[model samples]
Target chain A: MAERTPTQTPATVASPDPAAPPPRRRRRMKDLRKQPGFDTMAWFCLFCLYAPIAVLVVFSFNDNRSVVRWTEFSLRWYRAAFENDGIRHATWISLQVAFVAMVFATTFATMAALATTRVRAFKGQTLTYAVINQPLMVPEIVTAVSTLAFFVLIKQVTGLNGIGFLMLAHTVFCIPFAYMPIRARLEDMNLTLEQAAADLYGTPFQVFRTVTLPLMAPGIVAGAMLAFVVSLDDVIITLLVGGPGETTLPVYIFGQIRRGITPEINAVSTVLLGLSALLVSIFFLIGNKRK
Target chain B: MATQTEIRDPGTPQAAAAQDVMIHAEGVIKTFGEGAGKITALDNVTVDIRKNEFFTLLGPSGCGKTTLLRLIAGFELPDRGQILLDGQEIGHLPPYKRPVNTVFQSYALFPHMSVARNIGFGLEMQGRPKAEIKTATEEMLALVQMEHLANRQTDQLSGGQQQRVALARALAPRPKVLLLDEPLSALDLKLRKEMQIELKRLQGETGITFVFVTHDQEEALTMSDRIAVMQAGCILQVGTPKEIYNNPARRFVADFIGDINILEGELQQDGGAVLLPGGASIGALLPEGAARSGKVSIAIRPENMGLTAPDAADASLTGEVTNIVYFGAGHNVHVALDGGGEVLVRRAQTDAQVGAKVGLAVPDAVQVLVD
Candidate 1:
C-alpha cells in the first residue's frame, strides 16, 4: 500500500504527511466508456438505427417539391398529406381497424391471461401458453398467407368479403402482444387479495369488478395501447386481407413507396412514427407507475 | 359474557350445540396432488371452536393448521366429513357465501385503495348504504386507532399499521367468526408483542369468535383462550394455555410447547411414582386412562425443577453441572445425570459453578407423556 500510494497520487497538491500515505489510494477500474472504440461503436449503432428516421423527420419540413432536395423550412408536405383525400381515407381506415382490433385483442387477452394465471394449474397449461403465443412465434408472412387462403375460402363459400376479415386477422395476430403485459400484471398481483375480496362477501363477478379490474387497470391500458400500435403497423396481413375499399395507412404507404418516394409519404410516415412513440411512452409510464 | 338462550327448543341437542359452538369440524380429510406425490394435509382432523373464544391452531409449518383454517374459511373443501358453522353445514359454501372473514398472513391489503376504502370494502360488498359503510369504516378505523391515517394508501403504512388495517377490515362486516392466519408473523418482535395484546383486546371488544393459526407457541399461549396443538396433519391435544403447558397429553406437545426435559423411567408397582435410572424415585401424575405398569416417559418443565445440594432429601438425582446459560430473567443450568441423560433446571440465580456436583429436584407436576 505504501509503495503504490506515491505513484497513484495526483500531482495537483503537495503531498500532505508523506508517512500517512494519501487519504485514498485510487484504484484503476474497468470502465466501459473508457475502453477504446466502445463509444464510437455505440454511437455508430445508434446512428445506423435512427439516422434514416431522423432524415425523414427533418426533410418533412422542406418546402421544395423534390424529395431529395431541401429548401427553407415549411409545413407544406404535412399540409398536403392532411389535405389529400386518399391519405385521409387511408388514415381513417387504419384508425378504425386498429381501434376495433385493439378492443377485441385486449379483451380476449385479459380473459386468457386471467384464465391461465388466476386458476390452479391444470392439464395442458403449457400447451395453452404456447398456443396463445403462436402468432408471435410464427413468421408474419406465413400468417398472412394462411389467413389470405382461409379468407379466400370463406369468400368463395359465403361471398363475405369485408373489412371485418382484416380486423379479425389483426386481432388474432395482436392477441399475443396484448397477452404478454396483462399476464405479467396478473402474475405479479397477490393472489391473497382476490381471496380476501371473496372472503369479504364479494361474489366472483363482483370481486373481479371491484378488486381485480381496478388493480390490473394499468396493465389493461398498456396492453390495449400495445395492441393498437401493433395493429396500426401491420402491413402484410392488411394488404392481403383488406377488401377493395379497405386500404389502410400502411398499405397506402407501401403503394406510394412502390410508385415513388415523396415528401407527403415522409410526412405520413413521420406522423405514424410520432403516434407509435406517444403510445409506447404511455405504455411505459403506466408500467412504471404500477411499480 | 352472557349468552341469551331461547327457551323455544330447550331439549334439542342441535340447539344446545349451536348455543356454544361457533365452528365444528368432524372427520375432515384434505389431500393434495395425486398418486404417489399426494400429501394428506388434514388427516381426519376433528375440532370444536366455541363461540366468542380465541381459538388457536398451533403447530409448526406444514402441520395442517393453516389447512384447517382454510377449511373453516371455505377456501378448501374436505374430502370426507363435514364442517359446521353454528350447526349449519358450510363446507359446501363458497367463501363469499360464508358468514366468515379472514385476516391473511400477508395482510393482503388492496394496493389501489386507501385505508378507509379497504376497511369499508366488506360493508360495501354487502350492499350496505353509503352512509352505513362510511360509519362502519370510521368505527373500524377508530377500533384499530387508525382514524388519523384512514385516507392514506395502504402501501404507506408500516407492518404493524397494515396488520391493524387488516384486522379492522376483517371485522368491518361484523362476521360471525374472524380467521387470522399468522397475521403477526410479519412484524418485528416488539410490534408482534403489541399486536398480541391488541388482537386479544379486539376479540373481547367485538365478542366475535377468532380462530387464529400460528406456528409460534408463545404467540398461541399469549393470545389464545384455547389452543389445539397439531402435528403430522392431526391435532395432538386441545386445552387452555395453562392446561396444555402443565399437562401435555403427548410427548411431542410437551417438547414443542416449551422447554421440557423428557426422562425415561419405570413405573413402580404401586403406580404412584416413577423410578429414574439413577436409583431415585419421583412422584408422577399420570393422566386419565394411562397404563399402570411399564416403562414410561415423563416431562418436567425446566422452571418446575431446581438445583439442590447433593445430599438434600428432595433431590431426585445427583449430577454434575455442565453448562450455565444466562437469560435476562433467569439462568438455565445443564446437569449431566449420574447414570445417563441430562436435565436443565432454570433458576433466578445460581452459585454453583461449572463442574460442581448438584442434585436435580423433580417437580410435583410430572406429566407422564403418552408418546
Candidate 2:
C-alpha cells in the first residue's frame, strides 16, 4: 500500500484531471451543441481562407507602392490602372476567352451529363467516365505538360499556329467542373413530372422542351457561370498553352506582378474581384430559386 | 367460363348496355419480359365490363387485376390478344389517343403544378379554348367538392385532397371509361369509406363505366355491381357482390369474400339430407343428384348460426366455449366442438354469452356451397 500509494494517487489525479470532466462534459453538451452548430472546424477553415483575401482587398487601397505602412489615400494608381493598355488588352482577352470557353464548356457539359445518366449500361461507360473525370484526378502540372506536348504535336503536323487550341484546352479542363453540378441536378430531378406531361398528350420532345429544359435551366446557368469564372481566372493551363497574342487576365496579372508590385495591379484586382463576386451571387440566387 | 352477367342490369343505361360488346377482352395475354425469364402477369384473361356499371377487379396484390385495368386503359399492350373498347380494336392505341383516363394509384399529380393547372392539364394539352378549360376545370373541381382549394399547390394539399384533385383531373377529360387503381387506399379509414360512397355516387351521376381495382373485400361488396376476384394472374370468379359473398362457386371464394367457417367433411347424401365427416348432417333437403356421397366442404357464415346448450336433445354438436369477442353489432363466440374442432359463431349481443354451453343451429338454407 505504501509503495503504490504515490503512483496510484498521481495516476488518479492526472488522468481524471485531463479527460474525465471533458468526457462527461462533451457527452452532456452534445444535444445543446448540435442544434445551431456551424461546424467550428469548417468556420475556422473559411476564416483562414477569407481573412487573407480581406487583407488583400484592404491593402489594395493602400496609398503607396509599399503597402505595409499606410501613408495617405490617393486615386493616382487607380487612374493609372485604367490607362494601362496592357491591363485593358488583357481584360478584353480574358472576357473573350471566358465567353468562348463557357459556351463550349456548358454545351458539352449538358450533353455529356445527359448521356452519362440516361444510358443505363454500355461497354464504354467506364472508359468514358474515366476520361471525363481525368482532369480532376490527374495533377495540374501533368495535364499542363501533356497538353503542351499535344498542342506542339498538332502544330508541327498541321503547320498552323492555332490560337483556338488554348481555348479548347481551357474548355476541356472546365467540362468536369461544369458537369458535376449539371449531372447532379439532372440525376436528382424527379421523372414523374415528365411522365405526367406525356400522359397529358404531349409528345416526348414537347415534354422535354417545355418541362425538363425549364427545370434544368438553373443547373445549366450555374455550370456555365462556373466555367466562365474558371476560364477568366485560369493561369497554369493558359500559361502552358496560350499564344503571345492571347494573354488572359490572370497571365497578364502574373506578368505584371513579376515585373513589380504596383498600385495599378491592385485596381485591376479590385475590378476582377467585384466581377467574380457578382457572378457567384447571381449564380446562387438563380440556382436556389428553381430547386 | 360462362358469363352470368345480367344482360339487362337495372342500373345500366339502356342505350349503353344495348351495345352488346361495350368493352370485352378475348384471351388477353400480357407478359412482362421475354423468353424463359418472363412473368406471365396476365394469362388468357377475358371479361366484359358492361357500360355504366361499377365493375371492380377484386384481388390480393400481384393478382393481375390492376394489370388488367392498365391494359384496358391502353397503358399496357397485351402480348397475344386484343382489347376492344366500344367495339373498336384499341390494341395499339396510346393512353392519350384512347378515350380512357387512368387515376393512378399514386394519383400522379404534378408536384410543380397547382390544383387548377393539374385539373386543366388535359384540356390545355388538347389546345382547348382557355375559357372552356377554366370552366370545365372549375366544374369538375366543384363536382369533387374541391373547388375552393383549386389554387393551392399539389404538394401543399392533404392526401385525400390530392386524391380528389386527381379524380377531378381524370373526370375533366370525360373519357369513355374511368380507370381507378385502388384510389381509396391512399386515404384514412373514415375517408376511404366516405370516398367509396362518393365514388359510387360519381359513377351514378356521371354514368361512366368505372372499372376499379381494390383489394379490400368489404369495399368491393359495398361499391361494385359486379366483381372479378383474381388470384395468381387469373380471374377466379366474377359475380355480383351478393352472389360472390353468398353463392361463391369454390371454397376459396367463399372463404375469401368474408369471414366464413370452412367445414371440410365427408358427405353421406341421402334422399333429402347430407351428412358430414364430423357426423353432423346439414340441409333438410337437396335437389336429386345434386351431390355424390364423397368428400365435400361447406362454407358457413358466422352470422347464420345460433348456439344452444351443449346437452340439448337436438344439439348440432357438443362443445365447450373457448372465447367470446364483442363485435360492435354482435358478439362472436369461439367454441371447441366435440372431437377437437374449433368453430366461430357470431351472434347478436343478446344472443350468446362467454363460456355458455350451447349447441349450434346453422339455418336450413344458409347457402350451402359444396366443393
Candidate 1 chain B has its poorest 10 consecutive residues by lDDT at B1-10
Q: List the residue pairs that clash in candidate 2.
A: B266-B277, B308-B358, B308-B359
Candidate 1: the clashing residue pairs are: none
Q: Give the poorly placed runs of model 2, Cα more than 4 Å off.
A: A1-43, A73-78, A115-134, A141-164, A285-291, B1-23, B26-40, B71-80, B250-257, B267-274, B283-294, B309-318, B351-353, B363-371
Writing each residue's lDDT as its tens digit, candidate 2 over B1-371 gives 32322223347564444375568887888888668888888888877788889999998888899889888876678887888899899877876677787787888887667899899987887789999999999899889988677787776666677788888888887878888999988666777888899999999999999999999999999999888888767776677888787666565577778788766555454424456544667673222223655555667788876787676656666677889888799888998877677888888864555667678776664343433
Q: Which ranges in model 1 have alpha carbons more than 4 Å from their true place?
A: A1-38, B1-18
Highest DockQ against the true fold, candidate: 1
Q: Which ten residues in a row have the lowest lDDT in candidate 2 chain B?
A: B1-10
Q: In terms of docking quality, how is candidate 1 classified?
A: acceptable
| Best-performing candidate as measured by lDDT | 1
